[model samples]
Target: MKDFSTEITYKTSRSSGAGGQNVNKVETAVTAIWNVMESAMFTFDEKLRISEKLKNRINSEGLLQMTSSESRTQLANKKIVTEKMLELVEQALFIPKKRFKTKPSRGQVQKRLDNKKKLSDKKENRKFKF
Candidate 1:
């Protein structure tokens, strides 16, 4: 995961869900915003890749915004925001190692040839004389 020691800025807003009267009273939900261009944690190349991969999550100003209201506490929501940010960074940084092309081994080639010869012999024996 990318080492992001930067503190993400968040604004609290009430969520519209089945939370009863307490939902309307308390603004425990957290909405965090991190501008990809302004982030000091990621390099230019890393930011570009992350922005492209997470384009759907970013807003018009190229800010990666996320909201978490799963819990009733602001601290819990803040933790969720951090988790989400780390998750996105980890996903964007993942690069599959390239595989080297390889030919069939001699044992495998011989096995295939033997199977073909066995099938040919079996077919030859199945023929009926006039």
Candidate 2:
């Protein structure tokens, strides 16, 4: 896992979940923010790639927002938020290997041509040639 301690920032918000009275009272939920544009963890190229790939998840200001309300306890929620932040950063940092172009095998190409010919023959047989 990548280290995102310096990259990400966190904020607490009131949780709306199965915490009963605690949910309404304490701000236990965590909202993790890691702005790709402002992050030192990723390079410019990586940031651009992340911004493109995770456009939906990013806010208008280019900050990636992740919220955690799975746990009632603040510490647990904080941990979850931290882990998720790391995962998000790692995803952004990843460089996917380029795909190599290749042609279909000779046998597969022949099979496809044969299938096309069979289909054409069947269609032609359906028509009563005048």
lDDT of 2 by residue, 9-103 (tens): 88899988798877779999888888778877667887788888788899898888888989988889888988877777677667789999999
Going through the candidates in order, what is the number of backbone clashes in each?
0, 0
State the weakest 10-residue window (summed lDDT) of model 2. Answer: 1-10
Q: What are the runs in model 2 whose C-alpha is more than 4 Å off?
A: 103-130
| Cα lDDT, all candidates | 0.85, 0.84
Q: Kindly report which residue stretches of model 1 are placed more than 4 angstroms away from their true locations once superposed.
A: 5-7, 116-130
Write out the backbone clash pairs for model 1.
none
The candidate that achieves the highest TM-score relative to the unseen native structure: 1
Best by lDDT: 1
Name the 10 consecutive residues with the lowest summed lDDT in model 1. 1-10
